[model samples]
Target: MKKTLIAVAVMAASGIAFAASNVTLYGVIEEGVVLEKAKHGDTTVDLRSGFDQGSRWGIKGTEDLGNGYSVGFILEQGFNVDSGDEATSGKAFSREAFMYVNGGFGKLGFGRTGALSFAQSNAILTGWAFGTGYGLSSWTSAIGNNFSRMDNVVSYATPVFDGFSVHAMYSNGLTGDSEKWSDNNHYYGIGVKYQANAIRSSLIFEAADNKGTATADTLVSDVLTENQWNALKQTPAWSTVKDDVVKAGTAKKKALYVINYGFEYNLGSWTPMFAYQFAHQNQGRRTHMFGLSAKADVAGGNVMIGARYLFGKDKATKVGASELSVDGDVRAWNIGAAYVYPLSKRTALKAFAGYADSGKEWKNVEAVGYNGYQVYLGMRHSF
Candidate 1:
């Protein structure tokens, strides 16, 4: 079934690319039988949904703008393989949409893009090969270090020199109130990475000041309608989903910061990797995570074993409202292995099995119940 679907997708994509090769329409549609059993406070069944690799389809185009510069644009839409859901129930362009110009000097971009924190992770923490059963692996834990693909953002990335570079983004919060003292919501981040024949390393930092006078209630349930969302110069809703619960303060969480550090080392016969991330929410709450992963070739196939630990506390004091409560530890672990054998250049067979365990304490608060073991088989084809 996966093969048939891939063939159909390839044919459909080929028809569109038949006209020109300059534009590339490519994406990953990974779906299979995912059996989930949540037995903590309650027992239920939600056979399929995208929690690992997000199901998405994207179209990208680039044009030679001359003068050592080129302009490119990307429009992406996410779909669910299980129920064929679009992004989040009904968003047409839910994944991402952005435009940028690349040249000799640097890269200037506008629209929505991942934050610097996203780029600051180590290869092992990047979740590059973390699909399938490795749900609780280091890659999955790194999701917290991620940032919103900001909207109405003007970003500039400097050319790398000697394995080092930086990026700065400025967002204009048009809806932000003036009397609230929400200044220009600007963010700056810098990362320097060293990659050689056998090793790669990176460090990155991202910081933001709320400077917005938006009400705390909206910030908690901040997501407005999509049409209303797009009107602002740059709205915070782009990052926080409609259902994602937020706790707003009189000052808002406008002033937030996150930092991530990662590294990977390869030793011809085997390789190892490590990463650490820390996030501070305003002046009250904070969370930190550390992950380490590595595997080696055995019996002509690669095997991986990895783990991540996260500890966090959330605090908000209100006049009438009460403080949020959580107990036990906030930690999840996943260990899995996958073996791939090539049938052809673009075809391969993949089989993976994994076991993941998370805190049962927060089960009631979380939508997706925690703690279980999962196994799956997948086939991938590319053209």
Candidate 2:
């Protein structure tokens, strides 16, 4: 009877070992040389990492729990190949660290993960063509200050029905905690995607509520240093409206929102894509962006080219009980192209070049516009 019990325990341990054997490890390494020409006419060249794609290593595993139920976990970390440092300081798995359950009821995930809207934008919008690093879509989307990932996330994704699916997520706080529970940043995102044959489309919405307890003085200091403020005070234009500027800063902070839509169609040899975004922030600042791109197979490789336009509307800030109009409208545009040549199934050589105009500086003291150019050549390998 003792030998029988021991045999049963050995079998149970074997089962556990078999389940653990399902775990998989994966990683990508990319390094490149980059040349950047700043808007101020300064040029710099350096050996950069993650030009085509961010370098990362991850481990993942799944276990079936019978009755069609399964559980999985993933831990991914991003690092710089050039400097051999973590992408995010002090964080081990900065890219992704999440556990999930999957079954007939779709999937539910918890912990740190990518926002639904950001995932949609990255996969279906900007990242489809030349990737997000130097893509024009990335430049235009920055107007919304969108975060790619959030911590303490609770997320759900529905099973695909007729090539359509829905996803949603909420984060208690984007990053660090605040002294007061209500003062932390809360994030919400939702998205819908459809993919059928050669056509793909997605719509996503995201928002963040920044509940910080900041005063007018703090806001002013956040925007300008003492030296800059002293210099600005010497200007006649600034001196006349100094009091109003200070009063305008007294307005309470507001939530930010973004709506993004993307569509793509594949036509055998060539695929075309389009994207649009609307962003609002600070109760006054608003922006709109549009993007168009195309990709084609050439010379045993693929080439992607794209352009984007961004427009910022005039802003208004609250001053005490009244509204104060600020002349902060700006317009910008970007154009870029990328090429990828595959050496093998998991290795590629990539090149990219882009130009961007940042439009006029949005300050009462400055009315200057700037533009710049960038080029990168990189190699990427996956394992």
* lDDT at 52, model 1: 45
Cα-based RMSD of the predictions, in order? Answer: 7.1, 10.1
Residue pairs with backbone atoms closer than 3 Å in model 2 (clashes): none
Clashing pairs in 1: 182-211, 210-254, 210-255, 220-246
| 1-383: candidate 1 lDDT, tens digit per residue | 45434544665776843232246666665554544443333433344434444567776667787888888777777787778768644445565667888899888877655565442111112322342234434243322444544445667777777756555665554222222233334455555556656767767676766444233323321344434534432556635542232222344564567777777778876678777778776544467776667767766656666666666754433211222254333554445565665566655555555555555333333222134455555555444
In model 1, the worst 10-residue window by lDDT is: 119-128
What TM-score does prediction 2 earn? 0.79
TM-scores for the candidates: 0.70, 0.79
Query: Over the full model, what C-alpha lDDT does candidate 1 score relative to the true structure?
Result: 0.52
Over the full model, what C-alpha lDDT does candidate 2 score relative to the true structure? 0.68
Task: Return the TM-score for candidate 1, rounded to 2 decimals.
Answer: 0.70
